[model samples]
Target chain A: MATLKVLVTGEDHAQGPEDADVTLVEYGDYECPHCGRAYPIVKQVQKHFGKRLRFVFRNFPLSEMHPHAEAAAEVAEFAGAQGKFWEMHDRLFENQERLGEALFLDLDKELKLSATAMRQALAQKTFEARVRADFTGGVRSGVNGTPTFFINGQRHNGSFDFDALVSAIQQVMITAKSA
Target chain B: MAQSGASKVTPIHSDRILPAGAGAPNFTLHATPDQTLTLSDLLGRPVILAFYPADWSPVCGDQMALYNEILPEFQKFGAELLGVSVDGAWCHAAFAESRHLHFPLLADFEPKGAVAQQYGAYRDADGFCDRALFVIDKKGIIAWSYCSPVAVNPGADGILEALEDLPK
Candidate 1:
């Protein structure tokens, strides 16, 4: 169906080493229910693999479908500029049901980010371009829906449950080792 | 999966679609109760023909939903995206509204699957169109075609790539 347009690159918001053996990229929407469910599972995936895995997240908000999706993605990208993207990412998914201006303001205090700066960023729409770039990349990459995961450079056509993801990653790990 | 109440008809669209570089067959289909669209009317612009089995089938739902999301990309290439199925105009209207789709879904009803049969995408046994795609260039020639498994979503990557390759 959809193929990854550009592979994991220096511009991505990534966790783990730059040269990790396995690179897992998730094209996600914070306001999407399925992505919220995937949040904890992705955390477990990272914990299980540790140093062997590199995880990257890209914004892919379906703005027309989810009214709050674009705003949530803007907040995440703004937090990324302040060096707390992962924290904001987790908080957004964890507090998915309450995504709005007030929640973002509250998160600014909780995450020790600058409230004035966050407010201005949202008001001025500073990171809209950044979020849109990620979204455009996701669209080109064959991301048909929220929480579409790419293992290596290939699209994973199976389910994203724990066992399915783990086995898929292990298969990649094996392929890498043999090569 | 085949939709419930679909008739058991003989398979006629089992053959592959018209190959790339071939002249695309022409047909007109109803896009809405009051609107009709013809292949010839879309000659100057690129056309993405998305042929799915039925309106409400699960995989077709996902496929169309995804298309609804990236419609701007198709428009960016000066392309017309049309969803084709044997489902009637009323069924398409309901489905498009429920999904908030922004594109025209042509009804290949009346003589069901007539257009799909011209493109070799009709499935006689299933009594619906197969999940297929064809990207036609400005000259009304087939630029790309793909027949995906009936159960899969068949995302827009191939369609986008084909559109990108068309002459400016």
Candidate 2:
């Protein structure tokens, strides 16, 4: 089994308590259709687990296959720089169907981010390196595709649906508690 | 399900693929509708030949797309990656275009798996190329080769490891 090569650090975008029983790391692309489908399921999982689960997301954009993925990641990173990472992250997936310069600009307005700064950031690719670091980290961690999950540092090979993910996390929670 | 005695005695053909240290087989295959790529022509630089089953089917877990994403990593090793299948040039052209692939996807379609047969990567029963990967050195010698189960996508880690092991 492939284990996570890069551990979660202060640089990571995380939610929930740091002392949570389980940590779920997802290497996801913003424009991947499968990841789009998984978006709500993950939300459901997060809701189901609540304070017991910690979630982290990393960018693993397949730029060739999904043209807007890298830019979307950059946008999220830009939002992250301004402390609105989760809001931008959720909005990107929530509006995955219309991902482009126009959609990004609209998101900037809706999220109340600076239009000028966002435009300059996108034009200059200011957040590209940050997005690329996450991508490269995913690659080294045996991530060949988007929405790859690593539960508690071990790669999750099972389905990403609600029931499957819940059961997998439950099993991990049990093991963690026992240990 | 219980197997019959006849089925138990049936011999499976595990044809040996060209192993490491063997001289790589030279073949010219259609990289596009008009252009042909020969294995020997890329003698000075390392080459990676990936023989997958088909074009449209995600049987190999979108292996071509995975390779397409990591083309830069392969480039860092100064290696050229080529995807081969029995699909026609037109089909490959469409697939490559749709996937935005940077590497050339050679078509072994004219004679139908002729190059794959030479490399022992052809699936005789299925009428398509098996999911196989071959890393050839700068001197046209097989440095490493792997044949994964048809349902599995043998990721690029092995290829990268092999490239790292090659003489610099």
Candidate 3:
């Protein structure tokens, strides 16, 4: 089985308790349709598991296919620098179909982040290296497609729909508790 | 009809891909209508040859797109990736344009699967190349090779591992 090459650290954008019973890492592209479909399903899974799950998000943009993916990731990282990573991440996916400079600036205004700084950072590609590092980590971890999940460090090869993900996470939680 | 006793049977070679440590077969193929890329020209850099069945196919599209995304990672190791298929240059050009692929998709269309045949990656039954990957070192020797099931998209983990294992 493929294992996570990069463990979750202070650098990752995480939610819930760090010492939760399960860690769910997702490698996702901002503009991927499949990832867009998975967005709500992941939210449901998180709600179902609540405090038992530690969710981590990593950028795995396929820039070739999705023209705005890298820039969107940079926008999220820009928000992250301002302590609003999850907010920007949610907004990006929520408006995935309208990803562009206009939407990014709008999101900046909505999130109360400085639009000028966001534009300058995007123009200079400030967060490019960080996004690329996440991408490289995903490649090393055997991620061939967007929205690849790792349940407690092991690659999740099954479907990422609500029921499948919940059952898989439950299985992991059981295994961890027993051990 | 009378059957001859003690008739001799001839053995046929299976469609087995070239194994690791074998010298990579060199060839010149069209990367575009005007440009031709020779394997020997890329002697000093590690090369990844991804032979897929065709362009526009679902599995092949995902495989190529995955490679396209991780191209920078390959470049960090000074590795060049070339996708090979029996599609014509025009077909490859259209597909690459639609997908925004940065790497060249070499067209093996002139003799139709000649290079794939040399590497034993040609699927005679299907009249196309099989899903195969070869990591050739800087010295033009295959460091590793794998043939995946046609329906599956073999991820880049094996390719990256082979590149990492190559002598620096």
Q: Assess every candidate by TM-score.
A: 0.91, 0.88, 0.87
By DockQ thresholds, what CAPRI class is model 2?
Answer: acceptable
Stretches of model 1 off by over 4 angstroms after superposition: A1-3, B1-15
List the candidate numbers ranked by TM-score, top first.
1, 2, 3
Of the two candidates 2 and 3, the one with more favorable lDDT, higher being better, is: 3
The positional error of residue B110 in candidate 2, measured at the CA in angstroms, is 4.1
| Candidate 3 RMSD computed on C-alpha atoms after optimal superposition onto the true structure | 8.3
User: What TM-score should be assigned to candidate 3?
Assistant: 0.87
Q: How displaced is residue A69 in candidate 3, in Å?
A: 1.4
Q: Pick the candidate with the highest DockQ.
A: 1
Q: Which residue pairs show collisions in model 2?
A: none
Candidate 2: clashing residue pairs, number: 0
lDDT of candidate 3 over B26-129, digit per residue (tens) = 99999998999999999999999999999998768888999998887899899999999999999999999988899999999989999999998998888999
After superposition, which runs of candidate 3 have C-alpha atoms over 4 Å from their true positions?
A177-179, B1-15
Residues A52-115, candidate 1: write the lDDT tens digits: 9999999988877788999999999899998899999889999999999889999989999998
DockQ of 2: 0.24
